[model samples]
Target: MATLLLRFLLKAALAFLAVSVLWVGVYRFVPPPVTFTMLGDVIGGHGITKDWMSLSEMDPDMARAAIAGEDSRFCAHHGFDFRAIGNAALRNAKGGRIRGGSTISQQTAKNAFLFQGGGYVRKAFEAYFTVLIEALWPKRRIMEVYLNIAETGIGTYGANAGSIRYFHHDASRLSASEAGRIAAVLPLPKKRAAISPTGFVRRHGNTLSRRVATVRDQGLDACLR
Candidate 1:
């Protein structure tokens, strides 16, 4: 009986891994209709507004703003930013706000495939999926998908939806300041709305706008270019 159970578990694990790899590969050239996060919203009884935007359909400034606001070292890292992770770890040890230091790759993995909240098991799966995406998808595709899938507001998902709902503009026409505002709310979308931002969010958007110029000037965004 023990042997039979072990065999079944192994088979299931293998099947899951195989399916995950194939799924990541397929999404390299294809857009996913929905993601696990969207389903989670439905299960939570929150109706979501999501509009898929290709990288080209999204303004280049928005892409750069996301890179600046989310992961400044996005072009240099593989799947994780060990330095930022170490900083977050030290800060968590001190125990104030308990901030997380997830990279864009890790977040893309979670937003696209996994659930919210952090646990050892969820993190393990997140790491595995992050590796899958980083290895299979280019920096551009990763950004495109991230922009399309990241939750931007309550009951809202994706840049296009957020842009239209908030600024009354399409994502393709988002100005730098508008893009910066959208990027600033990513960390706490449930709490912050880009349209009428709090003082902190407004300042954060300003900083991200400056970082956008820095990333462009430093060639930190060369990977996507």
Candidate 2:
């Protein structure tokens, strides 16, 4: 029985490995359209289309704002941010409802590897994939994938689609404030519109804008270096 159990586990591990390799290959080579369960609503309601933006063409402002809003220590961390994770744990312990310690790496892992919303098991898988991605992919590649797959607006509007839909411009053309507004809506993309101004979005945008300026002034490249 023990031998049979071990064999089963080994097979499971091999299957997982094969799936991971296939996922990475598809992501790197195929410009396949990623469809999400939640994104369909956003696109249908907003009347937007799909698009992609390369890292070379992406606006520096959008990158900075994303760093500020999602992972302030992204340039310094490998796959996880201990400080943010600890803080999230403490907040959860204190009965805070908004307890997500996921880093940009973790989010990328979840998006790349699994479906949305399945509780702790999904989160565990996300962490596992996060470690794998950090080991196999560069920081730039990770960021690029995050920006490409991240749900930026309510319906099917990803970063590139959201950039064009809301701003009426390409991701490469986003200004600092415009980028901040988009980044601010990330936490609640399903509830917020990137184009329409809400009080919460405006306040968050301001906060992100300040962080972007600080990242710029302090030099984000220095952190990565």
Candidate 3:
């Protein structure tokens, strides 16, 4: 009975490997149709709203804002940022709110291929997918996919959708402040609105907006460029 169970588990593992490879390969060329997170929102009566925008189509400041706010070392790291992970771990150990060190590539992997939330099992799978994506897709492609698929607002997905919902404009020509505001809502989209942020959200958005110029000047988004 143990041998039979082992065989079944082995088969399942191999099947998952094959399917995941295929999924990543396909998405390297095609925008992902949907994600589990989007599906869950739809199931919960919050219909998914998304507008696919390529990296070239959106304002460059938007990408810069993401790099400045979420992952300053996005271009420097492969799939993980060990330094950021260490910093977050140390901070969490100090007994405040838990923090994550997920790089944009890792977040892109999760946003594109997996569900939100956490667990060791989910994290292991996320890591595997992150490696696959870094190996299969270019850095620019990864950024493009992340910006297009990331949850930007409640029941809304992607920068374009969020821009339209909040500012009544498309993402093609976002001002630095506008882009930063949208990026700021990324960490907790459901609870925050970019339209009229206050407190930490407003302050963080302002900080990100200022950092956009630094990102551009220092070529922090060099990979995307």
Candidate 4:
């Protein structure tokens, strides 16, 4: 019985590894139509809205804004930012609601491949997928995919979808400030609105706008360019 169980477990492990590798490899070239987050929304009967746009199809300003707002060191890091992770761990150790310090690459991997939230098992998958994407996909592709799949609002996904729903404009035409607002809400999209100027969002958007310029001036966003 022990021998039989070991064989079954070994087979299952191998199967999982193969599927994970193949799936990540396929998406390196292909645009993913849906993600685990989108699937969850659909299963919960909340209709999903997403319109994938290529990196060039959207405004460069939007990309810069996302970088400034989300991860200013995006171009400098490999797959993870150890400094940010250390800071996050230190903060959590002090006791509070646990927060994440995931980089753009990590978020891209999670959004594209894994589910929204799970315990250690999902985290292990996230780490595996993050490494796969960083190793397999280019930085531009990573940035592009992140912008397109990140949840922007309730039931809304992607830059194009969020732009149309919020500002009634195309993603390519978003002004720096407009793009800033969109990027500002990314951390908590469900509770924030890009169009309406809440005190926090408005201030945060302005900060991102200035940071976008700073990033450009310093060439901190050179990877996307």
Q: What is the C-alpha lDDT of each candidate?
A: 0.89, 0.77, 0.93, 0.89
Off by over 4 Å in 3: none
Which scores greater on lDDT, model 2 or model 4? 4
Worst window of 10 by summed lDDT in candidate 4: 96-105
Q: Which of the predicted structures, 2 or 3, would earn the higher lDDT when compared with the native?
A: 3
Instruction: Report the C-alpha lDDT of model 3 over 1-225, residue by residue, as the tens digit.
Output: 999999999999999999999999999999999999999899899988999999999999999999988899999999999999999999999998787899999999999988987788889889999999999999999999999999998789999999999999999989999999998999889999999899878999999999999999999998988
What does the lDDT read for residue 136 in candidate 2?
A: 74
| Residue 36, candidate 2: C-alpha displacement in angstroms | 4.8
| Per-model TM-score versus the true fold | 0.95, 0.87, 0.96, 0.93
Q: In candidate 4, what are the lDDT values of residues 1-225, reduced to their tens digit?
A: 999999999999999989988988898888898988999889999999989899988988888888887777898998888898898899999998686788999899889998977988988888888888888889999988999999999999998899999999889898888889999989999899999868889999999987878888999889877
Estimate the lDDT of model 1.
0.89
Q: Clashes per prediction?
A: 0, 4, 0, 0
RMSD of each: 1.4, 2.9, 1.2, 1.7
Candidate number of the best TM-score: 3
lDDT for 52 in candidate 2 is 70
Which of the predicted structures, 1 or 3, would earn the higher TM-score when compared with the native? 3
Q: What is candidate 2's lDDT per residue for 59-166, written digit by digit as tens?
A: 877778888888888878889999999999889888946767778889888776677889989888888888888877777777777777777765534577888879
Q: Which residue runs of candidate 1 sit more than 4 Å off their true CA positions?
A: none
Q: How much is the lDDT of residue 211 in candidate 4?
A: 82
Q: Comparing candidate 3 with candidate 4, which one achieves the higher lDDT?
A: 3
Candidate 2 global lDDT: 0.77
